[model samples]
Target: MQDPVEIGPYPRKPPVTIVDWAMLVLAIVSVIYLAWITFWHVSDDIHRTIVYVDYGVCAIFAIEFCWRWRREGWGWRFPVRNWYEVLGMIPVTNPAFRGFRLLRIVVVLARLGRAADRAVGDRVTAAVVNKFVNTIVDVIKRPITVAMLDEVADVLQHGRYTTNIANALEENRAELDAMILERIRKDPQAGRLKFVPFHDDIVRIATDTTFRIVFQVLEDPRTDELVSDLVRENLDQIKESVREKDIVRRPGATR
Candidate 1:
């Protein structure tokens, strides 16, 4: 039998297990600790005592990142999108600024919820660990995104894209065709034109949807007012021009 091809870190989705439980606990602790830091502000004495504890939790995430990278086998890329987690590893002597912590409450809670959802593994997307952490994380990542875009542009210039594309198409062709056929069959509006080809269906749907939108806009009172104003302006101009012509022309001359 042919071995499965390894594409990246998560070759296949991992099942929920004790590790997920541990990660969930760590996340809960992190949220509580952050809340304490946010509302009450950790003092120097307490910060010194729990400093290693903070480092230890951050270390676990850092190791997880490395573990995932190593598991990628041959096909691997740097986890640039996860740049936020690195902030967690940085040991701060003082609590983060009060204003920032207040802002991060929603972000931190949102990530914690994602972690919880992952543990449950329902109809939601699978995720683990904190979404790399911090309110400032978003603001600083625009430049990184640009840099990543540059890497993409660079790869497009040199990567074995056509070979990869051919292999992907070859592997998924049956499933892709099935998906197209299924979508066409399932589409309520397209069912009427069941005889239409896939491309034709797409074109018909887009054209019909856009045509309906245009008609709706034309029927709108705002559009009606705009057209009315435009017509009135043109009629007024035409009337003024005719009145001028009448004043200048001889009484018997053809206007």
Candidate 2:
């Protein structure tokens, strides 16, 4: 036999077993029989026997409900959520209220439907949805427009790109100075300069002055505009150089 399907608050075992289904069927039949007796107004001994059967069926349900409640650790929520079941299981002379147990049929059918969907429909639905999305994306996608590319280029060219670079350089100035000093100390040509009494002081002053001059030059708005204009003018030459190199490397290309 297939393994039982567990759902809801049941932790260690399946919430509904074969025995639970049997009890459910019994509860449903008892409700229908009680309804029949009420409609026909039966006053015979058979009515008394049916009444006892009704009590027996309700007892089974009450036991199953409590068993599930404790097993699943549902705490107080069980009574609140399944108040209908609680009412149906209450032993009473009138059969009118017993009809409420019929709702259990709806609950059972819903659970079964959910189980079936989980078993097969979930995978089928996901596959169909994935294919549909892929097809739509492949059909609708297009290359980015020239306007979009121009907007991106403008941001890089005229935005705070250079300002951010200058800020980063300022932040790492100490580290950069140390790296330059290390390089100078390791150089053979700088041996004479290292022997000078104020070598460290001279290097610090020179490095700071050079950094300030470069930073000022780069920070100038006119310098950025000039560089942009130069690149724009030479764009054709850059493209031609790349194409020429590509052609020269081709299998049948002549010198």
Candidate 3:
């Protein structure tokens, strides 16, 4: 649907996505802070500071959630549908549910992966996305708590899920062709450019091949294992470090 919100001359798309660098940075901060609180023992002063900072993050997320809720006409179902952002808003000061921000990472990663697929090859794009995701998750691995990356991956990569999308395109094929022809004729460079009739088979082949390549990457079984291993490795390393620290602090031990 076209955005109802009007710019000077045209309608812009709604702000359904909130994945900018500023928000991503805040999320990374939120996730790291959440991890620190979850995995490491902190002094009261440090804990208070974390609460102070996260309170701000929580307020921002809440405002965004409400804005989207109103704009999308999601009504009561908005919170249920957007439960991830809701998690970040549900008392960032409390620290128990501050992981909402990291969903930003998943959003960006998934989007970037798709964009890369359009810009380059599909298998190469998937491999790059998996590596990048592993690196970020690995960095936050020490505090990484979620275990269902595969679940989200499954949601993105269901088999034959784009059948409806292709059907819709096919249904509107004539309208799409007319719109393209009109735009081509109206272009300032129209004199230099000839309008070529868009073939129905062209649309079918393009959509089918694009979806196939993208889903092939998403359906990879190894994604789940890679995510699991990163979390496991980080936790083990943190646990060992804590044990060593405890031993050094023990009484009657050599300096």
Tens-place lDDT digits, model 2, residues 149-198: 44445555555555777899999999999999999999999856999999
Q: What are the clashing pairs of model 1? A: 84-132, 85-132
The lDDT of each candidate is: 0.54, 0.61, 0.53
Off by over 4 Å in 1: 1-15, 74-78, 81-117, 120-255
Give the lowest summed-lDDT range of ten residues in model 1: 122-131
* Candidate 1: tens digits of C-alpha lDDT, residues 1-255: 999965532322343456656666776776667666556767777766665676687678668657765665424344443334445444442345333443455545544553454455431322333344343454444434444444444444444433454466657756765666577668998666766567655755665565456556655666655654665565556556655654555356764
Error of 3 at 88 (Å): 2.2
The best candidate by lDDT is 2
Model 3, residue 202: C-alpha shift (Å): 99
lDDT score at residue 123, model 3, on the 0-100 scale = 35
TM-score of each: 0.35, 0.36, 0.32
Off by over 4 Å in 3: 1-19, 92-255
> Model 3 lDDT vs. the true structure?
0.53
lDDT tens digits, residue span 127-246, model 3:
654569667555565433333443343444443434544566668766866666566557788523444455444544655676567555545556545554566566556567755655
Global Cα lDDT for candidate 1: 0.54
